[model samples]
Target chain A: MNFEEGKKQFIQTWGKLGSEWGINRTMAQVHALLLIAPKPLSTEEIMEELSISRGNANMNIRDLLGWNLVHKELVPGDRKEYFVAEKDIWEIAKRISRERKRREIEPVKSVLHQLQEVEGDRSKDEVKAFTDMMNQLGGFVDKMDKSVDIMLSSDQSWFFGMLLKLIK
Target chain B: MNFEEGKKQFIQTWGKLGSEWGINRTMAQVHALLLIAPKPLSTEEIMEELSISRGNANMNIRDLLGWNLVHKELVPGDRKEYFVAEKDIWEIAKRISRERKRREIEPVKSVLHQLQEVEGDRSKDEVKAFTDMMNQLGGFVDKMDKSVDIMLSSDQSWFFGMLLKLIK
Candidate 1:
């Protein structure tokens, strides 16, 4: 692939994958472009390379930054800001896991917890049942989140090696 | 919560989460209902409970089955197929991880591999950059999936023990 072709393929595929995983398409594409760039890219550079509008590039770049997937940069001599993705794959994964947990899991847990507290004798069985099930699910999700934390915190080589063994 | 309130809250919250995660509202609500139900429920029952159109119910039910999140139950002497969610939270998580990996990671890997095969010096640099980044992301995802597999494959006691530690 030529530079243009490779960049196109990268943006398109990354955008598609992002939508599949619940992120918006442009946000993912912006992250992809930043991920592979040799240096922090300015917003104008991103707009030019992707052929996206300035507003679109600006908005999506902000979204990626909000997700902690990309970071802002200021060169010593540069007036405009540049952006870079979290380069270490493990760190990228860790930040994503943490953000998703906050956005998805915590809210679900809160709702489930509140639902568990409602009272009534005639409906007590159903309430008890709902709470018990929610508690169990919550606990399980909590465990999975812990596993992610532990995996992220551990030495990458050791964790990956152990994970590889477990998979087989 | 009373049965009506608790049930409504559960469905609404689950539906919201599902939409945020790319699944539709009714599909998530249906799954949420099934998640806590003590018994398998028929299609008509689901339609009635959810007040969804027959086509919508059928389609989303099929999707859930496809994701391995739900399954058919044939009650003795019953002509209609009933549905139930996989009750084990760990199992549910595992199936979700596997299905998501198959849907998202595998396809991206194929694209990455194809991009990696394009030939030319300058082209190769771009191709190499995208392919290498994607391959790294793919590898990390595969490893994370393995960790999920390990948790799913563990014996009941072992799994619960981990859950206990996590909850604390």
Candidate 2:
């Protein structure tokens, strides 16, 4: 396949993958487009390239910025804002890992903590078992939370370098 | 709050969390229900509890079974097939991580592998940069794949035990 064809296929496939994981299709597609693009693209250019409505394009771009996946760039002497994705693959992975931990893991952990304090009679089997389950699950997630915290705070190259060695 | 109230809130909130991560709302809800239920639940019980249609309940339960999060229990003297979630949080988590690696990461890695083999003028800057990005991304994902494989093959407690120590 030609470069353009391969690029298009990649973007589409990536977007579908994103949707399966819970991200909106448009947002993933926009990120995919930015990933393959050789240079920064403007809102207008993004809309035109993706053949999406202005509102859809704008919203997804804003969300991308919120996730730290994309950033605004100023072309020399041009007032128009151009958007560029963090092209470093490692950085992309880091941003995603950190953001997801913040968005998904942290909130769930908070709820688990609260649920652990549920006022109840511990004598009854039903109540005892339920609370015990919650505590066990809570502890499991707590461990995972710590693991994610370590991952987010550490530098990728050194961390993964040592990790690959240890795991291997 | 009472056990019932807390359980209800937990299930709802957990389902929302799953949605953000790319699992559909209903499937997550079903899993949540099974998670909190003290005993195995039959199709009728699940449907009534969730107030969902039979098809919806069955489909989601089947999906949960597929994901290794839920299992069938054959009760003595009961013809109905009852389902119980893998209430052990560690096992549930391991299943999810392993399944996601197979479903999402592996496919993307394969595509990246193929894209790296794109036949083109290697001397051109465009071709070079694009291929380099793919390679870098592919390499990073491969490292992740290896990490996941290790996690899957090893005992959860031992793996997490060693990992927590290493990360610390």
Candidate 3:
């Protein structure tokens, strides 16, 4: 494939992948576009390239900035603000994991903890099953919480190296 | 919380978590209902308890079966099919990871590989940046693929034991 074709395919695939992982498609597409751009791009350029409406492009860019995956860049003489993605793939991964942990894992873990304390009759099979499942789920969520914490805090090479060794 | 309140909260939380991870709300809710159920649930029971239409419950149950997360059980004297979720938490995690790897990771990696082969002038900064990004993404995806494979193949206790140790 040529450069243009390759770039289109990448953005499309990235958008689909993002939607599957609970992100909006336009947001992921915006990120994909910025990821390969030679320099920071103005919002209008992003809208034109992606064939997205101004509002759609602007909303996603703002959300991306909130996630710390993208940043604002000011050109020396231009009045318009430009955006750039965090080009370091490892940093991108860490940011996403940290955000997901905070948004999904933390809330779920909190609920799981509360559910585990349900007042019930232990001898009853219904109560027994519910409590047991809560305990199991709570334990699993705790492990996941710890795992994300370690991933966020550790150096990329050292963390992946040890993980790869253990997996092997 | 009382048992009923706890059950309601758990289902709501699980459904929210599922939607955040790209699963539909009702499907996740159905799965949540099964997770804490003391006995295999009939379609009618599920619909009534969740206040969902019969079609909705049936569809999600079918999907859960497709994901290998739920199974249909036939009671000796009853003609109606009963459904049960895989009660083992570790097994559930492995199944989800495996499915996601097949659905998301494999396809993205394929596209990344194709994008990496884009014919371009190496001297062009745009081409150079795109190729470099694709290569970096490909490497990370490969590592993730291997990690999932290891998780799938290893015994639960052994895998978690080693992983927890490494994280510490």
Candidate 4:
């Protein structure tokens, strides 16, 4: 494959993977484009490259910024804003983990905690089953929460190194 | 909250969480309904509880079975087929990890491998950057693949036990 062919394949694959993980396809494609770019790209450049509408590109770029996956860049003597992705894969992983924990895991944990307060007779099978399931779900989410925290706080080498050792 | 209210909240929350993670909202809702039930639920029961059409319920239930998250149960002497979710949280986690690894991660890795063969002059910056990015991404994904494999092969207590220790 040539450079252009390879780049296209990378972007398409990344976008598909992102959509499977709940991200919008166009947004992930934008990120993929930025990831392989040698330098920051202006909005006009991004629009031409991806063939996306300006509004669509703008919306996804804003969302990516909110997620801390992409950043705005101002070129010297240039009026247009440029965008770039954080290319360090480890840092990218950590940032995504952090965002997901905040957005998804933490909220679910809160709901699980609230469900624990459901009023009922303890001996009733219906109540007992509900409480038991909640407890189990709560415990699992807590473990996942802690795991993400550890990943966010620790360096890649130490974390993966230790994990690899344990696995073996 | 009363038992009925709590059940509603739990199902709603789980469904929302699932959608954020790329699972269909109705599918996750159906899984949620089955999760808290004290006994297996029939297709009719699932449709009534979720307010879904028969076709919709059947589709999601089929998907759940494909993902290995839910199973069909034959209640002895009953004409209708019943369904149940895997209630063990650890097992549920493992199954999801396994399915996702097969469905998503492995294919991405394969594409990364193929992209490595992109023909280009090593001295050219564009070619160099693309190759370098692919290598880095390939390495990171390989590590993740190994980690998921370890999680799948180990018992929950032993896996989480070691992971917790390592995290600290």
Per-residue C-alpha lDDT of model 1 across residues B95-138, encoded as one tens digit per residue: 87788877877777777766655554645555466667766766
- The better candidate by lDDT, 1 or 3, is 3
Model 1 per-residue lDDT tens digits across residues A61-141 = 998888898889999987999998888887787788788888887888778777766565645555666777777876766
Candidate lDDT values, in order: 0.78, 0.84, 0.92, 0.91
lDDT tens per residue, model 4, B1-168: 998999999999999999999999999999988888888999999999999999999999999999999999998899999999999999999999999999999999999999988998889877888898899999999999999988888887887777677655
Residue pairs in collision within model 1: A118-B1
Candidate 1 chain A: 10-residue stretch with minimal lDDT: A118-127
Every model's TM-score on chain B: 0.78, 0.92, 0.97, 0.96
Per-residue alpha-carbon lDDT of model 3 for B1-168, expressed as tens digits? 999999999999999999999999999999999999989999999999999999999999999998999999999999999999999999999999999999899999998988989998989999999999999999989988888888898877787676578655
Worst 10 residues of 2 chain A by lDDT: A159-168
- DockQ of each model vs. true complex: 0.49, 0.57, 0.77, 0.78
Report the Cα lDDT for residue A33, model 2: 82
Q: Under CAPRI classification, how is model 4 graded?
A: medium
Candidate 4 residue-wise lDDT, A1-168, digit = tens: 888899999999999999999999999999999888888998888899999999999999999998899999999999999999999999999989999999889989999999988999989877888898999999888888888888898888887897788655
Say which prediction, candidate 2 or candidate 3, comes out ahead on lDDT.
3
Report the C-alpha displacement of residue B50, candidate 4, in angstroms.
0.7
Q: Where does candidate 4 stray beyond 4 Å?
A: B166-168
